[model samples]
Target chain A: MKPTSKFGVLILVAPAVFIYAFAVLLPFVGTIALSFARWNGFGTPEFAGFDNYIRAFHDTVFVSSFGHMLFYIATTLVVEVAMGLLLAGVISSGRFMGYPRVALFIPVMLPMVVIAVLWGAVFNPDFGAMNAFLSAIGREDWRQVWLGNPATALPAISLVSGWIFAGFYMAIFNAAFARLPQDVIESARLDGANERTLFWRIKVPMIRQVSSVAMLLCITGGIQGFDLFYVMTNGGPYNSTEVPTTYMVKAVFRDMEIGFGSSLSVILTIVGLVIAIFFRKWRSTRQEDVEY
Target chain B: MRIDPKKLRRLLVSVVMTMSVALTSACGSSSEEGDKTLRIAFGSNGSDGQKVWDQAAAKFEADNPGWKVEFQVQNDDLYQTVGLQNLLTSNNAPDVYFEWAGARLVNKVNAGYAADITDLVSSSGLDQQFAEGAFGTTSVDGKVYMVPFTSDVTNVIWYNKDMFAEKGLSAPTTWAEFLTLCEKLKSEGVTPLAVGNKDLWVAGNWIGHLISRSAGESVYDKVMSKQMPMNSPEFVKGLTYLTDLQKGGYVNASANTIPDNEGYNLFLQGSAAMLPIGSWLIGIAQEQAPDINLGWFNLPAIDGGAGSQESIMGVTTGYIVNAKSTKQDKAVEFLKDAFSADLVGAWNAAGFTVVAKSADAGTLDPVTQSMVDLLNSGASIVAPPDTGYDLKMADALNTAIAQVLDGVKTPQEALDEAQAKVETQ
Candidate 1:
């Protein structure tokens, strides 16, 4: 006797569903449950309905962290996504050698901890590369405490993040650009379209899906990053560079306030979901699937 | 080749079951067997200190046949903030662990993580080693929770003796004289002081000491203990002393930017004339800049101060046995043997100010002897806010100090904000 295809498919999918529930789903549920109770992570948890969420709204550090996160996201959009698109276009036009692309990608391949450390030295207030550069150029008046000042700390770390990730976005868009129909580009070129026009009109619009994906990646990655902010500033010079993740870690691990940290995490998860939904809708409204 | 449907179905089910069981297996405890093995945990104190500890453990293991010892060494920051609690909650909790002496230790005791060692301390020979009052800091409600390990005179003003001698300047004994010394240094093109508040605690401890010395320990205690608000005129008065240093350009420009280690680097390289730090500076300086002659003084007498001008800001740290350990007596024995008289001598030589009197048998460096002398001369001993009071409240007050020093907020505005933060919490 032969089994039905649907039955076979169900059997094959069962293991994956089981594993997902075990690894991802269970922890998420635990977090949600824990969010409703007060615990210091050692003793028994006391039930407190919505207290943690309410406290998060009132917590000055938690509230300000969101604003800093927004600032960080804006910088990533320009520094990572926009710069990446520019690099992909410049390299795809064949004006630069392949070595430049590889060189640009080197930071992305390097370990994040090493990069954070290197950049930390470059931004050290007493003796940093930035201040040195300013001094060398006789522009000493322009030097600032890049990581210690609230005004410049977030932007400084964002630049470091971009330095490490712009190449990643470039690689993605570069691959997308390569997959474009050659005939369409050739015909465009033959019709007296200049290189810039071809890049903007034919190749750019075709890779819209990849660029949209890249933008989303930057936003989510910006929201998720912890190592850079932690190593460079640890969210100080008075909490200027704190994001939700860093604050959450501080609360859960450092302060051992698990319920509050869990609530903050749930809030972050919801915000991520809402943005993803909004982004999908916006993208759907802006463009349709392009066929070769 | 066509596959048999029944066979394929069974194979899929088996694979799913196996993966599920294997993945879920991670949730079960990987607790080590605790019968014959001893696990001692601590925050890393540096290679020299850890080597002493490791040697002590070696002797302990040798004395006890058929037993093994393992150490869980972690960074100081990680250990204080989160590592100890994580270890305590695990199935393989350390039999013995390290902790500070105040609210931090009290927190562990309240959470049931600390073993009540009042009887143990008396019976373990620790009672006869240190002074009787030394155990007072490690107690909660008259019951001891841990064994005292090291005494750190947490904050002091260390001046370069050579520089002072060259300039014909002497260590200041009063707030006014301290100001004059700073002015003299600044006029001579030498930065007078260097402070690192990047972690907030360095400046936090300094501010706490200033408040205790200027406003009186009672007023400082009231704010930290929640009886009085931090925004009081007393608190502001204490903090202004620090701000004065900033405004005069007598401290390094990167006061709030550099870390404690880097700030010390500035002092070691002769970028500054003095450094306001704790006794730990002696160890690092001895290793990094041994040729430089070092001189120090306690917090100077502030004019119109209600508190003791000669108050010493300090904190103690020690090891605690886990309350839930299956081998509590064994852990205590390990501690006694590991921290034996000979080992105490070794630790004192390594520059750890072991409170045990037997540690005096070893040779003491001049700087270490001076530190001990300074501790002896204090009119009173006060704990730094972070160690003595609630950490969150300390953070608020310390962060306020950072903002004021950075010129981002005025003294009144910063303290008011800090007061509000503590109230809300």
Candidate 2:
């Protein structure tokens, strides 16, 4: 009976295991092997173990680009998560003015590329509504070279990205908030708890699991951000806005250094693994306060 | 009451097998290949050129029994790079494709991704058809890798002839004279140069010409190759020239934010006096505002500089065939026949200036013809900066110029940093 059960279990799991190995594991192993070679994607790869890594370490653009990614992640985490939580709390309380929650969440339904194009028009220096508003207040001096100046370009791009993704996070938080037990909130209210205390003591701790999951998603996506920057800047103004993904792409496709680009990809994967592991550990250590 | 485990398991297995079979069947069908079909892929904005090529291709197919050509147009977005890479890797590259003529093509040649057409050029006698400098761009290691199709004269300064006459200004012949003219135009409340520095490449053209003419040709090449530091006196002079123009209020106040079309629009409206751009601007001017009286001249040299007075930057658009193609012989024959004087003449008729040395090459629009004449009369023609530098160094220089314009770094600092970066590469 035990042998039959074991065989049954293996049969049930084998197909999924095969699919995962073929789709993910094999390509990953190939990438790792390719990272140690010198290839231009057309000729035979010459073995140059660790040379790609050594060169990557010395590359100033790649180093600076990684630093920029961290800076972007930091800013995005604070702004997006805070905005999402605040908006979710407000809508969940049923005291928000005017619009329905569904109406407020409509921006999340639009595609990111569409949103980017709309914002591109709005940010145009000459005929864009942004500069028009600046001039309207007789503060024409404040009109900025928003996307053109190096100092402001990255921040401006980040603002657009935050705006696009904040609503999606807000919807996630809203759904999570709806699943929280109402009895706990009611008990807190009966004990003369203010809104802040109720939120901190009851709601926040209850949603910790969801929050951690959301954070993990944000970190992974943030690390892999390419489209927004690619569309807006293409890492312009002296590669100030470059991310690792864009750098890897330029190296592989534009420069035709396939092996070097593969090495960069491996570095990116390692960085992602470190972050995921750290987050998992943190989540595990934080005990769940909710009892079913 | 529960069903037997083996029966349930078999039922699930059968369902999975059915789904797999269905998916495989869905993906298995192939479209019928037609014998007459000849696939041609080209970049966007080639409709006019495509019309001529389609006519020629149609003629060729008609002459040959049971043959037709199918044109496949693809936008030259970032995907072109990806598609080309994939094709080269798989040894399934297109028969003929339009490619930029410098480091962009050199990499393909170095990897043996492009077919050697030495026989095609010599046997077909096209080696002597194109101008001497026109073929230099597509040559790698003393072997010609592509056939020149169109000429891009980069240092031409296009001006509104009527606007210049109204402002009592003549085209300047020296850098100092140009600055004086700029100051005069600015004092009269007109933008002096309609430049779109937002694209970075537009700014690069100005910077490249100034550096080439200011420091002379060889120094420009050295700077581009990173042998000379970007912070060298020559580069600094180029940056200072642009910065001074900005400070003097000679350029559009929002030049960095205005796109190429908007700047060109301003020029067309006569709000700006001059536009330093390629000869391609004549086509744009005709398309956008045909009523505007436009004229072109070579970019002026620095006063008392080592550079010749008539030095201009030149580029070419050309064709390259796939090295691994089984039909390489047929492809070579097609290119040789298609790029003859007749086709070259058709291109010239469609506003392109062909480099073919045939006496009956063709004619362009009157204004464009004049610009081509001016290009023909130039004392020297310098290759664009990217043509001289390797891929990495070219990107580094282009990016550094943007940083300098945005004031993130001083001209010296930007050049020094770029130099440091490129040297390491």
Candidate 3:
């Protein structure tokens, strides 16, 4: 390209760059700066280099919140991805299922807060559908306080979250499966490649990129899980279901510790960036140079 | 390059139109209000309080021809959680609003956000009319910052009279008898106390009452003021009593998971024998379970404690004007009119124990009347420990207490850690 044309392109991109800087970059920089100060969101902030970070380090609540996020992310990744992939494979292969896939995907279309409230009702200790079902099956003693018990609160919330998002992942994998070459599948079938082998050897390997993308989305979303936990538990039964974002909100807004809250947000941002970078590198290294 | 002038003109016209629309909408929304309009924001106090406030506002507006009152009521999540502090600091704070008394208001007052109402109270002769402790909560550093609206009697042991009768029980007047009653109630397959620690404050109510009983009102006052350590022997003994209540199965094992409504429901449904909550529970009991046959008594004294049975936990919810209010004169006028003899009488008629000289104590609900009598008859009132500590210290202590109730930590361990936090803060 000519130098004058390059200059013209740069001039054309100037407005977009300005918009990004004002809208996104400014807030990002402000948050980072605030992380190093002691602010109560009401008065003048005092500079306290690394003090907020040190407080975050010592805060047992923050540590517990991190553990909660990890548990939620791991359980959600395992359940949603595996179930999504299996269901996507089955639905794409012209199985016995007809409207079942559509029915399953309905949850993905609903708002997460609605899903949380619905699940909360279903898990009600006294008069819940789950308890009713248990009583009908002669297992009344097995009925559990699903959202109230610290032992089961996180898992129950994770299950609701997974149910809400799994359908989206399933739809993604299903679309990816549709774009796969039919000839390879036909040839594999002709060669007596069993159903399991076809899925494992051909379909799975082909959709590695889609799975990687899905996993990345899951990781980022899981790390920032706030609304579901907030609506369902508010990180209670004694902060047992707390996540990083919830903890940050409680500190910044509830306790008026804006500085410490910002530090937590910075930590979350760094962890998210590291994961994204690691995944990008792994993706690039694993990519095959295919000529079509 | 050749440009189509028509297309260029059209694009320019569209952009101009969009900008104009945006500017117009902004201006339309930004229009200023009349000077007579007084906007107040308060936490939503359920349907009953809403009705009473609505009636009062209507009456206020009707009496004042040109003045208008705009009442904004939201959930506790919005008002009590964090949004209230934000509102107080911002230019958008209400002219007058209800706030939790004690250290919560003290923080705002010390920050110079609330107006001093000392002159108003004195000139208006409210000091003589209101209860003794009513002026105490809003007074800080010799200046009054708020007007007490209603007093909450916090040591009331609301019990199901039907359940007590069925179990052949009577109200216990001493600590030993209270424990004996609890044991008997528990052995009879009823949860002795339908206590809920879900919101932390619900549990704090019980703990504060226990402290008042075990440590005496003076010790509670000193502890709340931070003159005594939280881990002091008296305070520790109070917590020990609470832990024993938990261990003895007097409290619901799952109470930590139950919210206030659910815990109240248990007591209402006869699943629990007692619920030691505020006198406000009387209204709730009347509304939810009118036929439950309820009775209340002050918390009994411990055998070897210095406290008297007359001591109780009492805090008043009141209104404060914004220090930066443009209509400060009008706000004070509204307060004066609102707390007038007729208005206070109206409030008394509406079941509230209003802190006004004009409030006819005899006209209050039977329960509220009794509570007023209790307050007037020289019952010692103690504020919660959090009423003295800073915001961070208070929240940390409340959360730690919740954890203790969940069996995550012993009372001593929790108090020790909480003490360290309070001292640091």
Candidate 4:
């Protein structure tokens, strides 16, 4: 481009760049700097020289939160992505496709707070639909206080998270499947390829880029999980549902341990960035130079 | 250099907007405008609280011209946690803000956010009006900071009177009798205790009561002052007592799953026979389930325990002046008016149990009057343990309570872990 055109492009991008720097970059840097201090979100911040980071490493709850984050990410990847892919495939194939597609996407349109509260009521041990269903089916022994039990709280929350976003991912995958060259699938069918073979070997490979993006998003969303648990459980039942984000929030806002919370945020951001970059690189390698 | 009229107009508008933004940002700085405005923040309770505060503000404004009071009411939970801290850190903090007593209020004083109102408290002679030891939580290093207005009695075990009557039971006055009462209630297929442990503090209050009854106030005083570890035998015994009650199936099985409101519903609906909670429960119960025949009793005393049978566990809600406020004198004057007989009586009529001993409660609802009478007559009142522990320690203890009750950990183990964490902190 010519110099004048380049200058115009820079001018066009200036507002966005300024916003990103002011909102994101500055806070990111501040958080990193704060990780080394012992401030309580007030008064002079005393320099602690990596005490917060070291404490995070030694803190049992902090360590468990990271583990929970990983579990959340992995669960979202498997549950949401698999369900999304299945829904998309069904819709694209024009089989088992109906108004249910709209129903699936409705959860994504609902506010997260509403979804959390709805699911919380549903999971209520006593007077909830889940227990009521169990009683109706005469399976009362199998019924559990879903969010109140430490063993089941995280998984229950993860399942709700998947239910909330599966449709959004399904929409993305459906669009990708629509853009596929149908002739290739028809040709595969004529070549005696069964539906399973067509899907696992052909359609799956064809939508690899979309799937990679979905996986990255799912993983990142899980690691940053907060609102649902904040509304639903507040990481209760003895902090069983705690992930890094919720723990960080409690530390900074509730406990007023700004320095410690900042360290947790820094760690969470770094880990998320590393995983995201890994997925990006993996996605790049899937591009074969040949045209379909 | 000829300018288009439209372009000149646009240029002027942009300059004007920029200058306005700059001035708006500058307005937040700590400088006096023409009128001396005192931003007074309180924990809000819908329109009733607003009306009462508005009247109080009007009265203060009438008495002191050239001074203004801007009232802001915040949610109770937020005010307890981030609201006060955020205000204290900001340059435009409220001249006076509502606060809960104990470590929460003391934390502010320690952080130098609350003004030393010792002289003001003494000069106003308000110290004589408040109950003895009521100001303990609001004081730091023998200096007063908070001026309490309401004391909530947390150790009361509110029970369904009709249920107790039907079962031929009466409120027990001793721990052994309480256990027997629980067993009798259980045999009748009624849950003995209605608690929503999901909030954790609801259950924590019970633990506080048991500890107060089992080991007494001296141990807790040591623990609060860091002289005794939290895992002392007294605390462990307290935890064991609660766990034993859980093991005996006295509490609702789904108690851990429900919030405080739902647990109260269990009592209101007659599914549970009793609920041990603060004085606030009465007002909330009256508002939500007025028809329920509610009766209350203090925690039953333990036999051969060091604690006094008459001492109750609770917290007092109060106001604290900002250390950085320029209108400290005016703020103190406003607080004096705010706690006057008529104002406090008005608050009591609005369903609040103001701590001021001189405040009249004749117009209060029956339950609120009973609660006020209990507060006034109780031998000694101690703040909840959660209020004395730092927020993190309090949370850990509360979680430990839940875990122990859930059979996730033994009481000894839970207390040990909590004490270790608290000590390290």
RMSD, every candidate, angstroms: 3.1, 4.3, 4.1, 3.1
lDDT of 4 by residue, A1-292 (tens): 3343444455446657867997999998999899999988678999999788888887787788888888888888877998899888777777757788999999999999999989989998867899899999999898998888888888888899889888999999999888889899899999999877887888988888788888888888887789988878887878777888888888898788999889989899888899889878877886773257
- Which is better, 3 or 4, measured by DockQ? 4
Candidate DockQ scores, in order: 0.50, 0.35, 0.32, 0.47
Candidate 4: segments with Cα more than 4 A from true spot:
A1-14, A281-291, B1-30, B33-35, B125-137, B359-361
Taking all chains together, each candidate's TM-score versus the true structure is 0.92, 0.87, 0.87, 0.93
- lDDT by residue (B1-425, candidate 1, tens digit) is 88877888888878878876886786674655647888899898788788888887788788889888889998987887778778887766899999889888988899888999888877877677777677778889999898888888999988889989999999889988999999999999998988877888888898789988888989988889889998999998888887787788787777777788988888888889998889999988988998888888888889889898888999888899999888887888888876777788778777888766664452788789777776666458888988888878888888998898787888899999898777766
Instruction: TM-score for candidate 2, please give it.
Output: 0.87
lDDT for B340 (candidate 1): 75
Candidate 2's displacement at residue A160, Å, is 1.8
When summed lDDT is taken over every stretch of 10 residues in candidate 2 chain B, the lowest stretch is B30-39
- Candidate 1 lDDT over A267-287, as tens digits, reads 999988888889889998986
> Ignoring the other chain, what TM-score does chain B have in each prediction?
0.93, 0.86, 0.86, 0.90
How many clashes in each structure? 0, 1, 0, 2
DockQ of 4: 0.47
Task: Compute the lDDT of residue B31 as modeled in candidate 1.
Answer: 55
Expressed as tens digits, the lDDT of each residue in B75-110 for candidate 3 is 777887676766666545678988768877887786
Q: Which ten residues in a row have the lowest lDDT in candidate 3 chain B?
A: B385-394
- CA lDDT, every prediction? 0.85, 0.74, 0.77, 0.81
Where's the lowest-lDDT run of ten residues in candidate 2 chain A?
A1-10
Model 4 CA RMSD to the hidden true structure, in angstroms? 3.1
Clashes in model 2: which pairs?
Answer: B129-B357
Q: For residue B249, give model 1's deviation from the true position in Å.
A: 2.1
TM-score of chain A of each: 0.94, 0.89, 0.92, 0.92
Per residue, candidate 3 scores C-alpha lDDT tens digits across A1-292 of 3444444455456657868997999989999999999987766889989988887877777777889998998998977887788888888878846688888799988888888778877877766798889999999788887776889889999898878888888999999888988998899999999888988888988888889889889988999888888877888876788899988887887677788889999998998789789878988798683321
Ranking by DockQ: 1, 4, 2, 3
